[model samples]
Target chain A: MDNTNEKLGVGLLYNASLPEYLEHNIEQVDYIEIIPDMFWSDEGRNAYPRFVDLPQWRHQLNWMAKQVPLVAHNIGMSLGTLNYFDKGYIQFMKEMNESYRFRWHSDHLSFIKLPTKGPHDHNAGIAIPVPYDKDYLAMLREKISFITEQIELPFLIENNVYFVEYPDQDYSETDFINQLVSTNDQANILLDIHNLYANSVNHKLKARQYIDELRMDKVVEMHIAGGNEMGGMYMDSHAGPCPDEVWELLDYAVSKAPNLRGITFEFHESYFPLLRFDGLNKQIEMAKAIWNKYTLQPYYHELA
Target chain B: MNSPDFQLAFATLIASPQLCKQAIADEPSVFDQFALTEKEKTRLRSVLRQKGMSICCSLYRMNRITPLYTQLTQTATLLGDELITLAEEFWESYPDSSLQFKEEVLAFGQFLLAKLEVGTLKFPYLQEILRLELAINELSYTPAIIEKTVHFDYDIVAILLAMDRGTLQTERLQKVQVAYKVYLEEQTLKLALL
Candidate 1:
């Protein structure tokens, strides 16, 4: 749905290498979300090999920013951890933000580490779902505040796909998220559609109803992807195209997300072939058709 | 052929519906091999005989079949050496043999190589397949012949066979093999330069 006043943007997370992705596909979409870790190199603190140096990355990012608004979707910033935030990572992210001049940055509202004295478990540096409890909420607010203060850009927190059941959770996922957003006024929410879909499928909840209850005003961006059904659980596998159900949810989300700045299409290289440009073209066409059917005004910037 | 350990190990490996589909796809008779215990075999067979191969096939298809392929390659590599050594000695003794005789010998070599590669003629399970392939190549023919004709080496060939049979395990290996196969396919494009 192309709303002239609202920022209706189509995004691909970290698909910069594929020429067709940038030249062919992204041309049709609006705004691209780059995972800074993918481009980071060993040279400088946040040196990304893809960009070579800060100056080069700046030029490329600026160029992309000029084409359409650029947003940084980070995977490394473990927001829900009990441990202190990585100062090196924070500094690097700040530097990249300054260099790229991103619209806004967001990370998963999950823990990637535990407070330990020895070397951190670098291997398990994956975004893990946090227990939906008040204790966690208190810790999370402090972390979000610290991040927002360091980086002037609006810090957005994303909902994660939790596999294991939480026994000690004091509130529902929605309540926890709503509380976090309310406490941290500057913080926005990155509504990952697939994670929502997965949680609903696994936990047996209505996906739309969950979206209906979401604090949509705080949502700065949205993530959509495909999932794999395993052990009766729908794992968020970004290997294939988004299913019809997820698309329907996105349509519902668009109406709900009043302050939604952008919508990101998350796909990983491992499952890139399943999308096959032709198949992806059809999906994009479907998305466009849906957008056209819903929104009354078709803005030129919406296409950009 | 029917042993408790073999049945237990094989049954455990193919316990998952996805794993059973892959095992059956690779070797249709693999299910029959487990016929020693009808109860266990029937349970495994029912999973495979389901209406939709969606869940099992998708899981198998998504996972990289490289480790299984690697295991097959290792077997072939070792067998290739034995076959080459035997063939060379036979050929050297009877250098002026007829075409029929030559064909017979070559057929025997291929058969032995195939059987060994399939993990039937086993000693080194999966880990030593590569080393055995190299050893066989070294023992079997001249370096020039191997360098010029053996583009895949024993390890690569074994992997390809395992992939074809759908017996490969481990997702990471499958991803690597898929990329490697794509790389192999791209080599044909390079031939245009010639």
Candidate 2:
């Protein structure tokens, strides 16, 4: 969804370690994408004022909001969750948008929270991939429609990294995404290049071919990350700095995605030592180098 | 047949590799609770057969324990190898996690306390470590200015430092009973010996 055609330029997914990095190298960051769930502790489904702000995290966010454009990359929505949609979460995001003025928001096209009859829902602890079937597509469309209605900003759906694939599915991942984005002009894609790489290595599929099949124009943002091999499979660990192959794929993806607004580099906070400030700056520089080649001149470099 | 049923089954399998094994063994009763279609059952059964299923379970375990280890570092360190068995037992008993960091950390702390009280899990200084970590965690999340005193039968600060340095000598540790104050100062958790 093109809420604003203005490009977001290079972005970094905010993690626990970025506070130190941002202290000295804030200039290197064009934008900061925050996972909002990290900034608060939800007491439960039944607590009064359920969302309690983490003072330290909020203090950091409040400062960052003034320095650069802040976009939200949420993990809590679990939008692909079947038979249940978290309207309260969407409402909270609306409140967050009011506070941070997020240019756009996105979440994975997977389910993490499994609702039950208990006092609290069960968290799957990992993003479980949604089956690419018509029923799921319909469910996602309804949920996205509800979200966009509640929050007018552009909403992007990130592709999932699957360790195992369902045997029979209605559509390919690309086909499912294309169909989902067709729901409305406000719905779009956040393509993750490393997820494609992990899937390619594990499932022995062509990453470029998957990209080729995707509707590139719907790709409003792209995620570049690194992964590690685990249990005889390439896992999308987001370990640290992007691999050479992912940068190459990002180069290809940027070339094809004419409407791309942002390129986010993600790494887990625990790997901060592996990606010291220098490593982070290099990733940003490389993404900007690719972004500069394909995007128009002088995009939204900072919040004005 | 339905997505929720499939999701619940998948989530159950992730949380319990025992059930994943049961499903892999083609034990029909493993998924009897879910009203799944024959195709759904077959797909889940096939998924359990894949090597990636092990990865899935392992990843789930890693994620599940992250908040615990990150928030309760000293307690986790003290538990060491015993954490694996204790965590599995805790999950088996208290299967649902709110996924809230505060909730998970606190829940695990309470679970350990219950185990210690029941004499199932034992350690000389486990209670002090768990209680100290729990207090710090609670203070970190407490928005209002609050203070609480936690009493330790041993020198916890030295023990935690030794634990961090990997030089803890349980027998040589000081047996001084001390009270440490945990409170929030300037939005950060602070600890002081009183």
Candidate 3:
């Protein structure tokens, strides 16, 4: 899957409010990035057909798939979970790809699902950041190999937004990501600029320095969004439009990431009222400006 | 360092602030259930003391309750400020959420139904609204169009409208027993008076 020359312009992460928006403005979007898990319901491990399609959601997804190219952003993989791996979930993803024909797929570098004694697995209710240690990296590498074998799509791991950082980690976040992608050919990065901004505000770190340390070529996609202040900390709540700082970071990131295929603007559907169709268009327009600035000319000329 | 156990312990702490407080207080048996390595235990203890842990716990509760808020809008809106305490109690009883929207909504709906049946949760038209919302959730997942009926003993439309307006007054509304058929037709929720 050589996406080096592929450049998908500004896109939106699919949400419940998107059907109506996409209906009127399909041409404005280059592609749709969907969370495949949202389109189906997983009955517990005991159920014969463990994954059931929610017709209403599938109807919407089918409608959108016809309108534009789609990429899957998954939340169920939980690849960082230590000993537990749901090959069944990966198998289901393969079936979904067969049906939808996604361009590429990605999941977070964090764990959310924990196996429980009950019939269903326990959701951590949040994506928990994994410790950047050699042992965990090795664990993820094996899991990534299995996933790539099962589904031949380009796989990406999004950098996590950590509210709490573990003590005595083996590597910094950028080094960890660089090492992981260096070892796995099919694995790359989904550079979430908002998550980096959140971490910068919360931890008092330089976001640019963090970005500079990263292997820019590994970045295939980037996410930008708005968040609000909670408990005196700037949180990545995805509440509304992208902040000015996020746009700046995205501009810098886009200039560096030559292989970047998409700049996805994410906002929770509940915030649809805040970012009505017009507001959403504004975000996409801003992203396209950055995209065109870097993607229109030769990479070297743009840098010069 | 026993990554599974460490994850379990961390997840448990996030879901229950009571356990988090105990862990912070250095309660001897707070983490007796997990087989965590000493380093893991030390890390958990240190992390719990950070202010971000509070945010993590808040985020956990918000995520668990989102399905309920989205699916059971009328029931949740009617519960008003009481939803927080009720949700906390519900989480205390059932610590793990499947994270599936229908499953979480149904689980929370069943929890509310049990409370309403036992006379512990009392309110005018509460049962009717809850049953309607739960039916809608169930029907959204059901592929085939099928009708399910709910009997309401009050002027349900007036009640719902007033609730939407945030000016619900049960005493001002009239009592009228009626059965409404709730079903999904062509992927759209429709209601018919029966």
Candidate 4:
């Protein structure tokens, strides 16, 4: 099946160094989403994804897995880039999956490669977006298909934020996503509301318009988070409280994405200190209220 | 645009605002370096014209230098105006960055150490500071014991310990014989003076 049969309610992105406040509120979160890239160091450029000197991180990840259901949210897999692929990064994911037995795994829909990954592939220093076009879609199809064959769990590509405006193309951003789903059966959308909200504001588009247009059934998981505003531009900085605009979009989106299994709250570690304990719980509580509603239906599976 | 050309264009334009402007102006000579197709060049021009490319550069520069600022506070403070120039040179020398932050940082330290040895870097304390920072990184990333001998008017150990231990930075003009040992225990590097 394209989507998971199990259910995953509201969860918090787990960093080993979570605030002391969250320790008391651990039970408030249903599950934890772990970004493997954060825990393991891919030793220098040509080391080919070798884990380096992260003994403490390995211990923490092992401990966290025993506590609750842990899902792998990968930040390193640059699935959209076509020419060169990081076979080592793929291998790392496979090894991690074997150890953690993550219910599912996801990566950003952007390209982030080490210099050694390809010839003439300059490092972008950040997870920048890929172009929206038919050839681009074809590239993703082949890459994603290979990933699906290698990793058994359901894989998702989170809707990433892009600052660049490509010249007009055959597909809108929504159309590009829809085509991606049509290409691979196991592939699904990780629908990041905050990213969508940021893109809408930055590009002067409608959140509702894109949400209604997308094939919501393909959305197996969703993400919501807060970001910082620098120089009048809303960034996907993942810095602070969930913006009102994202929450507003979430209120409308929850009903539309019927197959949605998980809704994760993402915030960077630097921003953890800026957020109050009460505020974090309220965001979880808000997600719970919505999860509690849809979960009442027969369509929603039991929480894993 | 094909993936290779597009990826190359992104890397070039993001790293250099001057190239973005050149590409925007339809300067074939500038974008030819990136192997950009005519269509890719046009799209890149459109995007860079939106003025977000500068923001991208700023955001990336901030992420890159954040660790340097935190770890090399004294070095950065001492260099002041030259720090930016040093960083740009380092970036040019080693364009590829690792996701492992300490790797990127240690590489910069290595670059400085090379510069210092080659007489390209002229500073009173460059050698000592680079040695101390690189030693800390070495200790963190590996358990291999490090033994070194050096002489200086200032106490390098005291300044390093002060950064984390809050010990006061004491100034003493003395050429003292000392042995330095560094190793990791419980995620903290233990520096022993013998």
Candidate 5:
């Protein structure tokens, strides 16, 4: 297969543990996705705007940014929070984007911070699932709009792997995602196939039906990663190579998503030995073969 | 108005397992301080009674535990038998887990130090190990960490070498009058013992 699909490209998420793999196969992948939080240390904060010290990662990251196509995937946006918008976080993102010039920015749909004024105003410290209600849609839409205006980039939200049950008034999870993106054309989706699969299996929902329900036309990028079972619940762990189920979803997504631009693989640093050393090249080969099938066969009537 | 309150309440409950236990029981005043509406209170009641407990506890604890494990490896090792229980105790002591890695680690280290200062924690190597770990964390991933040349206040190397592996002795370490410089060079921590 060729290096990239003219329409869609394959990429690796930049995990620090796999420098050898990244360097060895630099030409193989077309782009690199990076998490912004790793580049800086948080100083103390009191007011709305918090200052961070970034002298450490400046030179190294700048050098990496020049190497491949850098796309922004932030974990700290806390978009579902009811109280705070994290304007400081936005400012930091803007500054980083200015330096790296990322193609597009995306964050998870989960709420990492509880924004209300109370004792525990600190971030929830993990991507906590948000309620899938139409009532909450207005809030998330406004937040997305605010983020869009502030970042001035084509923004997207990845589907969250939710475990909890929240009271929903109207919309199911897919309904919520579909309506959210359909409201604005520019707003897109980074359909994390692993997350979708994990959530479906964990919650006893049909995985294929979930994919069928998604507004695939809105999907711009897709994520493939591995997970593990913990406490009888499946996690979007990113701990190993792509599971067969996720690969199948990737094929389905590639066939369905007309506007898809990227396919990225993710794994935590702890699994570098297993995934990077053993399975990375094979994963890339499989992804390339599928990318051939995906981009080769026409998905859109106009293109055909 | 209610959603914000509900979020805050749920976060608080997750952070405080004791309060969650109380809220789960048939206690009306357990959630009095929380700013929850009637509907929100009903939902909280449902969560406590019927669903979401497993993930709620796992998510809350895992988030807090990640940095703790990463930062305080030696201290965690030192408290081998008491690690799990003490971790929970430390978390309960400082309930609000911060995303700031340094602050959270430092605070937990200090909490252990306080436990050592009192008769609460009886681990002999806790103090030096925690201090050394904290310094390493502060220095970060750089190749070298430099500090102003000064006479050593703590003789960490001797305490480490002389201390028996058995019993994890409780005798207070005598601060040896030695001058030394500690820094990382060539990815190794070098101590200039004088």
Candidate 6:
């Protein structure tokens, strides 16, 4: 395959336990997404205690940056809290960005920590859902601006899965997203295709129409994954193979978003047994075939 | 105690003290909102005043007595009924044949039944309750009837029952009991051995 003709790339979100050279397997894929938080802590069994310090991880991450663009997906920026953003966290992220020099950085657009009457709750790191309202939008804009100021890189926000019940809100999901993008002209979006599909299935909405209505020009990346069904709802389980609906939605979204930079395959080791890697490879082939079919020749050549 | 409009008056008294007092002092137009007849409203106001006074006196001493005593009593009764049902199900599912294994199984069942009476077992208590039942299920297994017999080897069955009880007591039940303040750690420890 002509490297230039491959405008799209398949890449794994780097897992620390996986040998660094595992990147070679999906090397044919265009770009790799590295989760900075995974490297932030040196506690896990397979994790390199000095992964952030190691030249190979840094050099290889940067090499991956040159060979194929690298994007930073973060897990710790609690964007939805009333409390001030963690300056230490922002500083750490700045240091990492300086070391690897990623194309962009994205985090979930939901709160993880809250103002409690006790010690800052560290265990409350799970992404929490926020109501779509004017007040919430204002809070999100301030947080996003703060992050953008610290990183100097374009900030992207990914939509999240909400498991708990929330009181009725005035705005719909599309309206909420539209307002967020419009408020921050510099903001980019990471559209998790499976998350959108899961939300549509759980909430009973037209998934394709939700994608159709989005400001696609603002979308820079897409995420696809599998979910487990729990308590009459599908938990965004990230544990299995992508459903056909999600793949079809991805194809439709690619056609819609002309500026989509890359697609990431997010796999969790805990649920690795449930996934069919062969099926995932076939999906990638399907995505590339669709990209070839729809992408205009001039843009394709320019990417080449 | 048997006032025609007692329910309406009681609801009003519980909801708003100011409204209840006004209603007692002089029937108000808001009483009309309750859709009570003139006689019924009078009867309701009289009974509400009596009940409200009694409640105030009860509350003054309620702290000295056991809080939620009525609720605890009802819960214990319901749990006891559930335990009996579970015990009956276990017996029906596994008819006793061996004297030693049967006694062991019945002893475990009795332990659970005792715990249920204490009102310490948490919701979705079936899994733990069933483990005790399964341990007793050994009596149902007979080695001589090999052609159509349930396997209940001593080590395998004992290990499984131990594992199940350990998970139930330590992992599932303890986490819920602590999280929801359903039972104290001391109380849970006492029940665990059972």
lDDT of 4 by residue, A98-201 (tens): 88888788988778663455332345777878787788888888888888899888888888787767787768888888888776788988899999998898
DockQ of each: 0.03, 0.69, 0.69, 0.46, 0.43, 0.02
Q: Which candidate tops lDDT?
A: 3
Candidate 6: segments with Cα more than 4 A from true spot:
A1-8, A20-24, A42-67, A115-120, A274-280, A296-304, B1-194
Residue A2 miss distance in model 1 (angstroms) = 21
Whole-model lDDT, candidate 3? 0.87
- The full ranking of all candidates by lDDT, starting with the best, is 3, 2, 4, 5, 1, 6
Docking class of 5: acceptable
TM-scores for every predicted model: 0.57, 0.95, 0.94, 0.89, 0.88, 0.54
Instruction: Tell me chain A's TM-score in each of the predictions.
Output: 0.84, 0.95, 0.96, 0.90, 0.90, 0.82
lDDT of 1 by residue, A18-109 (tens): 44456655677767788776453322223343123333344455666667666888776666655457766787788887766777888887
Cα lDDT tens digits for candidate 2, A172-216: 999999999996999999999999999899888899999999988
Residue B147's lDDT within candidate 2 is: 86
lDDT of 6 by residue, A1-304 (tens): 2221123455557664334345444554666788876443222223233223333345456556666666789876777554446656677788887877677789886655433333232212245455566767777788888778888777788977654323345577667777887867557788998889877876676888888788877777788888777546675767657788888888888777766667787776545445445554665666566556556546643432
For candidate 5, the lDDT comes to 0.73
**Alpha-carbon RMSD of each model:** 16.2, 3.0, 2.3, 3.5, 3.9, 18.6
- Calculate candidate 4's fnat: 0.40
Better of 2 and 4 by DockQ: 2
Higher TM-score: candidate 2 or 5? 2
Local error of candidate 2 at residue A193 (angstroms): 0.7
Error of 3 at A54 (Å): 1.9
Against the reference, the lDDT scores of all candidates come to 0.57, 0.86, 0.87, 0.74, 0.73, 0.55
